[model samples]
Target: MTLKTAQNIAKQFTLVKAAATTLLALALSATVMMQAASGASRVKDIADFEGIRENILVGYGLVVGLNGTGDSLNNSPFTEQSLEAMLERLGVNTRDTDLKTDNVAAVVVTATLPAFARQGTKVDVTISSIGDAESLLGGTLVVTPLMAADGEVYAVAQGSITVAGFAAGGEAASITKGVPTAGRIANGAIVERELGFDLATLTSLRISLRNPDLTTSRRIAKAINDFIGNRVAKSTDPSTVVLNLDGSKRDDMVDLLTDIEQLMVEPDQIARVVIDEQSGIIVIGKDVKVDTVAIAQGNLTVRITETPQVSQPSPFAEQGQTVVVPRTDIQVTEDGDKKLTVLNSGVRLQELVDGLNALGIGPRDMISILQAIKAAGALQAEIELM
Candidate 1:
């Protein structure tokens, strides 16, 4: 072949290779976009159905069969009264009798009655010592009636107390872990009445978002409507999404809710920075942005050390006496080597973190710097101190 024809063929092959590479790159980009879009959360995870919640039930009771770690009768008069009343209920009259018992403790029992709980359902209960009891370990809670806010008994709790903590001590000191005064029993309370709500009779349902955001609520409503092929879901507020079951295509609310909850929708969140000062924890959201700002943080450190030297008399010295001489050493340091880190305008969360990290700033100092940036109106996100 001629050298010119060979050169032309080589050029054509090179062009073809470049075109194939471009196509592969475009395909990879599209795949990444699709994966990112599919990474959204389901509707059930970010929101809760309105009327479906647990009710708090509380009761006062006595925990017996403790190992001499119960309430002192002298200090806890309520314990004495409760003991007498309990004895009377058991057909043993102990009125006006000197009752000295170190095995009984007055306690408060608490449990949560779950939503749609039937009469036979059993729920977990927590028992806490109200008197000055040393521990509730190895104790059995007496029969107690758990009541709701309206002062109506809904369930009865009586079981062995399972304390997660214990205390052991001598006359000198004591050591304790967890909370010996509190305990939990799995399935200790039996539900006696139902919460007076029927989910099947509801014509409409309200979905309350755990995190209130207008964009998220609207997105959820849109996703529900699109999945059902009807405009039955509407965002009434930032935190509420109302579903019009009457206008929905499906007549069964259960099936409709199941379908709606399984629908995946990308939830939006506000740009927020959370700072926990006590624990030195700072969390910056992915959407957090920062305007153009320069931040410089430095610390002044001063250290003082003390040393004492004893000056003793020599063997031949007649008038010299022993004495202690105090010596102190102090050192001061200033971090003047740190330079100002200038964050550019519209910098995202990663860039902001990188800029801060470049200054060798720790979490505690970064919290103060973020607050300062917020005060200066340079941080384009809300700072929530927790």
Candidate 2:
């Protein structure tokens, strides 16, 4: 081939290789962006909408059908009084008769009413014995009206009690498993009313972050705005984000929430190290860091002993008398020589842990050492003692 033809061929090959390299770079960039997006979380998983919550409902009730472990009516006057009142309502005169039975227990029932819950919707209820009843297993809760804090009845609960634990024994010895006095009734309470707010009529909505962080709040707002292709979402503070809904989307509030809640956003977290002294548990976060610090551990032991000695003079000496004297001895010792080991500056949690582990220290000693480092401003994370 001619020299000019060979040069042209080389130029063509170079152009093709450059195109391939550019395509590979673009592909890698896209892959990285996709991976980052996959690791992000939805807005609803990290934040809760304002004014949308559960309401607590509580009520006093009675449980019947227990085998033989019921509250003593004599000791629990309220239990007897409640039973008497219930019986009187059922067209029975129990005031004259000494109604003594071991098949009844007084219980406090509790349930939660979800927001926008309609009438006739069932909710789970929990029953707890308020008296000295041994167990609530196999008991059936009576028809009890659950009331909210506003003194209005919201639901009625009634069903067979299902206890997670059991109690069995005699007067001298007994064995109990779990908490026998507490039980639950699934789908026991029916909603009698709904809340006052209407979602379709709402012009604005707000989200409250579980953990308040300025960067997270801004990112959430930006993600929502970008997803909707408008600047409708705004971060009001570190914990709150407010959104303005257009008139066209007001009728489709459910659809709007569905889209907004699914948008992904990365969240920020504080570096923290949590320690449970009782359980000797140490949890170090990945972002935790430490500066150069020295640690030394030592143990001191003390021992004491007592001895009684008898002193006697000559048996026939009138001026001498037998006597007893107490003698005591004390000893103290310390193990291991004191040596301060200098730990290099650690920029990662693993490095700090490795340095601490090299000292052959336990969790309790690690907790003390971490606290000392934090106090000395060597640790770059917050220390939480549990």
Tens-place lDDT per residue, model 2, 81-132, is 9999998899988897787898899999999999889999999999999999
| Model 2 deviation from the true structure expressed as Cα RMSD, one decimal place | 7.2
Model 1 has a clash total of: 0
Q: After superposition, how far is residue 23 of candidate 1 from its true place, in Å?
A: 20
Number of the top-ranking candidate, with lDDT as the measure:
1
Question: Against the hidden true structure, what lDDT does model 1 obtain?
Answer: 0.92
Instruction: Estimate every model's Cα lDDT from 0 to 1.
Output: 0.92, 0.88
lDDT of 1 by residue, 88-115 (tens): 9999999989989999999999999998
Clashes (backbone N, CA, C under 3 Å), per candidate, total 0, 0
Residue 202 displacement in candidate 2 (angstroms)? 1.2
